[model samples]
Target: MSPQPVLLPRRHWLAGSGAALAAAALARTGPAAAAGETPAPGAAGATKPLPAYAAWKDPSSLIVHSSNTIETRRSAFGTGVITPFGQLYVRNNLPAPDASILAERDAWQISIEGVKNPRQLTLGELKRMGIETTAMVLQCSGNGRSYFPDKPGGTPWQVGAAGCVLWSGVPVRWVVDALGGVDPGMAYLTGTGGEKLPDGIDPKSVIVERSVPASAMADAMLAWEMNGVPIPLAHGGPLRLVVPGYTGVNSVKYVKRLAFTARESDARIMTHGYRLSPPGGKGDPSQPSVQEMSVKSWINGPGTDGTRLKAADVQIHGVAFGGMHAVAKVEVSLDAGKTWQLARLAGPDLGRFAWRQFVFAARLPAGQFTLASRATDAVGNVQPEQRMENAGGYNNTSWADHAVKVSVA
Candidate 1:
């Protein structure tokens, strides 16, 4: 069948104003000492306080992982924008205060409200709460934002706007139950982080407060461990919120408080930002933007050096993901953008929220070439080349197929 034809208006805001508020909050909480900086270390050049939506602007901080042994043209994927030694994505909630300011052990506390007997728990108390582990892919809603056809109003994001890691922590329901179960009429559960925003930015803007229905709280988790250890301070140490299948914006980081209420929260951070135009333009003004991740795939191997391969057998590999559903198919193309074929898939075991690995092996002919891949879900949702326009920076549904230059020896 021919490629699906969809018209995505050109004017959409990829990042939400709430994201800016979160960034501004981090800047005001005081500079996170340079020690925890991940990717680039101490090489400070263009390191400026990021706007709420500009989380992935720092290039040096991106985490790079490649399976191919090629060293000349390195292939890797990052969680977000590259910062000093790690990648940055504008998180909807504020970051935790630096260890230097709060001291890892004594700096944070978790408060549970709206229960019959609310209580405050420290990180140590939380550790004893029977922690469960899950491997999840934490991605910004605007991960491949730059790919969006140039438009006004959106956060600037490159390909490295997402990351996958094993997360470990206490389930949100566990904490709520420990506080003597929730009361009736509770429809929203709000989470608060410990970080503060900069001087000029509005505190109302920086403090991220979002609420989910009590029914959804059963699945919400408070993660403290990542990839087998306590989550790094830079990555929301002590505690963070993990709401699987929802856009990263709803997964608040640096979690400090949880409140159950009968009414939906009026936090501007949750209501006004990260929202997409509802299907058929009938938007739900009351519902928050907590939809499943859209299907997406990326080409990450055989960079500049692939150009030297002779017209022989070649291995093309990349990654694919569909928020909560199984990736039913992944198609690849080699002739610029003409014909297409299926690629081998691996890794549905990583859970519904993780990215799957895929590969296509074919005999390439001696000539210049272009390559691309598109992923489809079991729900019949094929990845789109673009998305419908909106004001916030929410570009989750756009296709990320890439064209790389290669030559045969």
Candidate 2:
């Protein structure tokens, strides 16, 4: 666990303030913000403006469930090539980072340890080593927990806790490689977000630290920039780990440490949480850990379940992704799963980890209808009709398995 002292870079840390925000706000005072408008670009660091979702090309009408737990409704899933940064789902386990901290991105530091020669590096230094960008989906392990058959007692997320983001940062392996290469014997490469918990919570129980398999280091990045901007503090700013194809928790926002070790952190998150327990059972360590997501798809538009509309040629569109590969094909079903129609894939293939957007259209007479979709990945993985039940609701991709009914007047 020996880590060298942090070597701060030449960049000066910026300070944020309210007056600066007010000045910036005045310029963008459109009809939208009646007064005291949210700050636009060039606002001081202190101005933590709410991101523009409904305000900027927002279609799904995303919901805010606390600053940290917002949900992206099903209609928004296929709205665009990239989920708007402001409208992206939020699932912060801890309090969201404040503006001051995010403004200090230049000073962000991560301590690397446990290897033969450990060292500490600032965000500036990490960028010098190597910078790569990959667009991928960051999904909460329990995104659809609310629909679990057994019923879990945690956040009732309904497939809204996931989004595709373009993340850019130094390869995590660069850190491991810098630390004199990894020792093969080590099983897990542990890391942690630097956020502190409240006084009453037991420090040991807090999952400030969690980990990914060492093999995953090859695809992981210690990202400081997301979606072409400095990573917002709300997401995981200053720095965060972006492990493509893994659950969002594995991304570990506000990251500050990296340790390659044989033992998993005793933190509740690593052991008790994120487990795939048996149906109706509490988390069981013996069961497999929640890692890659399963094949899944969601019909995003033409309104949500039970949506009523006049008879017309309704366009049905959605998004789908594979656990470990690009989505090869996506199919939609109107009369439940009795018949399926291949939907057209659209836009660019950001990467295997990024979901593929699909669209289908049909002219409907006045009547009641149901819609459903299934996806097949490049690796031959097919979306299942029924989700595998687990008490924790870790990977509820099966939420898309059922038919959603809509009314056509």
Candidate 3:
């Protein structure tokens, strides 16, 4: 079942040598692993597969943590997580190659040089050169990182790292207008991932490389399906690089080369990890981090540990997003964060960049309780309980504050 790729609208070519000093020599060599060592065969180790749910809860007792439960429901705007499918959240940076040698290797190319005819193409020539889908929403520039207050260097991720899927691929401005447009002094576009820098880490580390610009690579994209299947190898199978609104570490995974520069590409995961710092301001380890993704929201399940209302009128779903916009509203606070109300949004099936599920209803006020939620987008923004300091903890977004503890006689 391998043969899909046909979508056009190309233009791209930018040549090299700018490298920004090899992106500071790959961020002073830093991703070779070895501190506790274990990630190698398809990496992201520690034991890998998770999300069965039976135990492991704590992240303020599930306001949303325990690695962000995959799915759950309670209603009246009170218990939600619902990510579903394989439980989402994979977030790899590197470590997912060898998918049966990429489905029996049809030679698997995809070269595309600066463009105008650099060519390499394969995966059935990008599915006869005409595939496109795009739903967007990747997240994970560290997702939440244990809520990072001070303990943040890399991947402590909590809000289940993030996900939205849909992808499909080929756009990226039709491979930069078929390789012949983006040159106007092009300013960065790098991207490489086929998995290789493991062994004790630091093959000149630098997160293994990923750069942006070229107007964010003409809105970037190369994905090869996901949610519509074909994108599994730990979540980067065959190809990946969706950058829409950024984050997810510049949306790169097993991508294996993209080039087109004028500067920025020495990789160390693109000049040292998913950066951010503007809104409330604070991050600037010498600038260069704002990779996108900000407005966020959460409220996974019967959290604050206090569920018992077998019935009596309850409904409080949750899930709001804002990496690319279009959430617009979703408030619900029971008290903990001090007054808020307005839930019920849910209508926009996957495009405003995905993620928008809200509900609200209450009629129990009998025993114990604690509930919360907050989200606001459509440009209004909102959603920020903390995050804004940045140095390493990368983009966060903040606004967590979820809580559950219900009991209503």
Best by lDDT: 2
When 2 and 3 are scored with TM-score, the better candidate is 2
Once superposed on the true structure, which residue ranges of model 1 sit more than 4 Å away at CA? 1-74, 78-96, 199-202, 277-291, 304-310, 400-409
| Per-residue lDDT of model 1, residues 206-300, tens digit only | 57776666676755788876544456555666688887656666677777888888875566666565566443242244534644577777665
Q: Candidate 1, after superposition: displacement of residue 329 in Å?
A: 3.1
TM-score-best of 1 and 2:
2
Stronger candidate by lDDT (2 vs 3) = 2
**Residue ranges of candidate 2 with Cα displaced over 4 Å:** 1-60, 399-402
TM-score of each: 0.72, 0.83, 0.31
lDDT of each: 0.57, 0.69, 0.56
- Deviating ranges (above 4 Å) for candidate 3: 1-113, 116-135, 138-150, 153-170, 180-264, 268-297, 300-317, 320-345, 351-353, 366-409
User: lDDT value for candidate 3?
Assistant: 0.56
Q: Please give the distance, in angstroms, between residue 287's alpha carbon in candidate 3 and its true position after superposition.
A: 23
What RMSD does model 1 have? 11.9
For candidate 2, which ten residues in a row score worst on lDDT? 5-14
**Per-residue lDDT of model 2, residues 153-213, tens digit only:** 6666776688777677778887777778887688887888887777887875775677677
Q: Evaluate model 2: give its TM-score.
A: 0.83
Give the candidate order by descending lDDT. Answer: 2, 1, 3
